[model samples]
Target: MPIEPQALRVLMHLVAHRGRLVGKEELLDAVWGNHFVSESAVSSQIKAIRRATGDTGQTQQVVRTVHGEGYRFVAPVQEEPDAGQPPRESSSADEDGLVSPADQDRPVVAVLPFVDLSPAARHAHVARGLTQDVIAALSKHRWLRVLTGAATARLAGHPDVVEHLREKLGVRYAVEGTIRLDGERLRVSASLTDTAAGVCLWGDHFDRTFQDLFDVLDELADMLVATVEPEVGYAERNRSSRLPRTDLGTWDLFHLGSYRFFQFTREGNGEAQRLLNRCREREPDFADAHAWWAYAVVLGMVYWDTEPTTDLLDDAIQATERALRSDDQNAVFHVLHGRVQLARREYQAALATNERAVDLNPTFATAYCGMGDSLCYEGRYSEAIAQFEHAVALGSHDPQLWAFRTYGALAFLFAHRFEEAVDWTTRAASIPNCQYWTTAHRVVALAQSGHVAQARTEVPDLLEQCPGFSVDYADHKLFYLKRTDQRELYLAGLRSAGVPE
Candidate 1:
């Protein structure tokens, strides 16, 4: 009669991407880690989830199949009602299957790469450069998870794949634009697309004298960020997409690092580390690499312990500083730096960093997410919840899905909503992605909520795999639940559940 962990994980992901038909392939990729599983495994799990939810394939009623595409969640979710607390305000879902309108009441957006109409390889470089610049400007939002440069570039050239990109990445809106250069003259155009509606939300074009290249790019960044800023429900005056430093060749280092950064596995993360390290090595003056390298250490740290975490993170701070020095104008670097600052428990500074990042990169989802987290640390629980829920609306394929779930659960736990805390943490523990030491928190939440039997079962594996996992990453200054009082209680509960830790 109980729900299985695997099925529960699928259901959680479904809820995360609920209200829209998610492609089966996307589900496999996001939930099952794609490359390692069989379609039958997914099919089998779907059936199990249906059984848990009290649905049959004939009625396939709750999780409906969309013929050739994928499955969708039809039922509205109830948070199991946190004990002693009333349901919070709810917003209407967004027309874009990506962001529910309720989510918009928070704020987030994705900036796609710009297209290059010129065939010269140099023109391609220009398009990607323009995109990287825009990305930096928009990354200031701490609560946002805007697609990284590489992901946007991958989708940039293929406007035809926009739908596929939307479905797979799970973002509400995308900023698609183009750049064309005619001898001594420049033209740039940008359009905001509601991924689900296939309609342009806003469109604008900029023309500038070729001699004023930097000015032109800056103006374009300003215009684009401003245009998308209000749409995400943030004020235009708060926009601050400036990279902290400007001397570095952001295009080369950023893209190279981005291509390597997505490897996602322990080894992939290592390769990313190597590439970003190289970027730092070559561009010692480049601050962006530091920001990225800090992010890389965070990513590498997420899967397994590779570096002397303290040393790796310290280095991340160094990299972020260099990026800030190069061009302090981009919200990307600011949000990223805020993450590192947050890890250091520079709470006030981190919040300022995230706020600044959002101001620069109004459409940046990670900024919104970071804003929520910073607010949580500041005991702004409701605001933090709004930011987390908003970032979830923007969606992400980050190697850190479990972290997101864990962080969301932590917010609930600390806010003293035990039931909601238990639900989110339990969902996090069941993530099919790489495991982290953070699983201990889920056990802690379960035990605290008196779900001792469940606690007894998960802690042993949590210990064996991430026995020493502590939730401190210099990249995201979240001083996680470190006290062992609850961890010990969790161990006792797991023991009662017949788990040996």
Candidate 2:
């Protein structure tokens, strides 16, 4: 029953020229513009329009075909007031805005067309391009439902645009911004607002040169997408904390679980799993919820020494399978599935799956990290390091930054680059709320670099966090590594760090 964009356009055009025949060529120009699509495209759109409006070829009650000429709207139609007019006040348009009961379950966001603040109107295209780029980039994530910019374009100039978006479009978050041109230089200002809560969650300004517009657009888009996802997550987590337990929806619970999962502690992992379980219970078919729950279970197994029983492994596998079955195109789900493959020592399968994840979302940092992990296990250290670096660059400020850095250090160690391993692991350890496991890598790297004294000093903390750690445990952790020499070298470094035999 959903009207597609092209069909909606056709319907609107028909309504505008009601009672008059609109030529095929005119319809093409109005809808597709300069695009060279075949007449079948228009026919298909007309068919879709008929299906959506319950009009039939036999009846032709609404949209009448003109046989060889074009089409006409035979049905009477009414038009709303022009968008330029002041919006009429309704019960839904109170000071804040109305929130639909259904929309409360998920985060809805809309990216408004950027305002052009250039002295010359000729640079308006640049502003529009940036807005499109941001919307395209953000649309790659499956978690947030991103509304089309065109849907909110008219409301962008309203004094109460945020409230309007919230009430009319049911948008929980609104991203609005302006672009300014100063001759050859460009500046962009953007802000993200939690419309329901009436709070500005985050805002920033970006400056660039107008050398190559497309390149600049890509850069700005990447940066904004990277920033927006985490900022939204942070905002949602804060909002979830204030809500009563009974009021929390599946999405809210998942974000709350992720906030705990990223802490990388024993208690946090347990709590994350508990919340993820509840999330899955609430929405069994939610792919993202299933993926995160599987990820949390795997992390508990790897770090928290949770029993990796057959039932536990099956739970993780089934959750991932369910996620992939629901949305195979989702990059995060593929990455989580790849992680399960990696844990099961299916190196080749994991590598291919992670590669597919990257293919699905080239900008997904976690996919690259998963690929790096697989490559490192295959003893392709240099290639793994490259993948890790790409992941780190894309996710520099992401919640998984610590994991990227730690994996990068591991890749460096496998490549026999001890000094680089020490440096990256140190940075990972220095990050706020870094996982405890990073210190273990630092100890091994220091020992391998012949800094035995420094390595010895780090041993106590690592031992306290991972008691009963041994060379056998190190070997178990590196089970995916095909090369015995690489695994042995890693164990030797751990041994030199005074880990138990």
Question: Distance (Å) between predicted and true CA of 3, model 1?
Answer: 73
Q: Give all candidate RMSDs, comma-separated.
A: 23.8, 13.0
Over 1-501, each residue of candidate 1 has an lDDT whose tens digit, in order, gives: 577766766676677567567776566655554145666776788889888878998887679877777788888677553589542211221122232221221223567768776546357777777788777666554334455675555564574655765666556567888888877678888887767667777787877776777777776675566456545432211121222224323333344455555534666567667766775555344454567778877656545446435776687777787667655766778877887776665667888888887666554567777887677766677888887776654434333456666677667766767688777766666665534435655666676777877776775677676444332231222233233443344344344544432
Q: Which candidate's TM-score is highest? A: 2
Quote the lDDT for 321 in model 1: 72
Cα lDDT computed for each candidate against the true fold: 0.61, 0.78
Model 1's C-alpha root-mean-square deviation from the true structure amounts to: 23.8
**Candidate 2 local lDDT, 1-501, one digit each (tens):** 888877887787677567468767656645664456777888999999999989999999989998987899899766555679643222111233322121224577889999998886677788778888888788787666677767666775799887776654557788888988876787888999989879888899999987777787788788788778777877777777676777666667777888788778888899999998887665455566677888888888777767666677788888898878866877788999988877777778889999998887667788899999999988888899999998888886678888999989988987889999999988898778676568878888899899999998998888777787677776765544567877788888889988887
Clashes of 2: 0
Q: After superposition, how far is residue 308 of candidate 1 from its true place, in Å?
A: 5.7
